[model samples]
Target: MADTEKTAIAAHLYVALRRVANRVIDIEWMAQNEEYARAIIKFAVEQGNEELARQALRYQALLDGEPAPREASARAEATPPSADTVKKRYIGTLR
Candidate 1:
């Protein structure tokens, strides 16, 4: 593809990503219209906009009351209580 065409497509993805991020595009549509959402996300991935695609998925997961996989994994890595702390807190219950 020509440089201009690539730039234009990138700009389009940027706008779409921003619209969803800013809530201007009603991300709830992602949940209600799965095909449309998948098309947007697929285009983003094809164009190498993985982060934008991920953001779109995150929006959908948020609408569904769940964390996106990356977000969940990141949370799991964030702050696990130490084994000692858990043991101390649950000592009586464990016994």
Candidate 2:
């Protein structure tokens, strides 16, 4: 990736991580309320912050005394759809 793209990605990753960490701390401070935890995860996923979603999942695992889910590697391996795919889907919807 170009330096600019790399920087943008890094910034986004940091923000997502921060949000996840904050949510986790909030849950802990709230006495491990399941409702609060679920709300955080749902909001993260709904906002298309996959990193945050994964972090929330890991938090839940740890809360249950299980191993946290594998990190960075799993996300890095998944390919997002290309512009061509999006264009095709958009055109199809016009039919």
Candidate 3:
């Protein structure tokens, strides 16, 4: 989509985001309307808006009454050791 369209879409998401934050709109309702919530998250990701996407996901988790996801360090701790963990094959895979 054109830049103008993306901006407009982002603007709308901002309004929706505010509505969620201010509790003018029920979060449970938004959570039930999964597509709408996902739209904001997807847009943020597509636009390279990492902060926005992270916040949106956190809010969505709250709305859904789900536990927030673990932080990166915690995730690392939870991860099972891979074969050849010492070498860490993925470190070279990106090259």
lDDT of 3 by residue, 8-36 (tens): 33454466556544323333434446576
Question: Highest lDDT: which candidate?
Answer: 2
Task: After superposing candidate 2 on the true structure, give the runs of residues whose Cα lies further than 4 Å from its correct spot.
Answer: 1-27, 63-65, 73-95
RMSD to the true structure for each prediction, in A, is: 14.1, 14.4, 15.1
List the candidate 3 regions with Cα displacement exceeding 4 Å: 1-29, 60-65, 69-95
Candidate-wise lDDT, in order: 0.51, 0.51, 0.50
Which candidate, 2 or 3, would have the higher lDDT against the true structure? 2
Q: How close is candidate 2 to the true structure, as a TM-score?
A: 0.40
Whole-model lDDT, candidate 1? 0.51
Give all TM-scores, in the order shown: 0.36, 0.40, 0.33
Q: Cα lDDT of model 3 overall? A: 0.50
* Clash counts for all predictions: 0, 0, 0
The residue pairs that clash in candidate 3, if any, are none
Per-residue alpha-carbon lDDT of model 2 for 12-59, expressed as tens digits? 434675665543234333233656555655566665666766655665
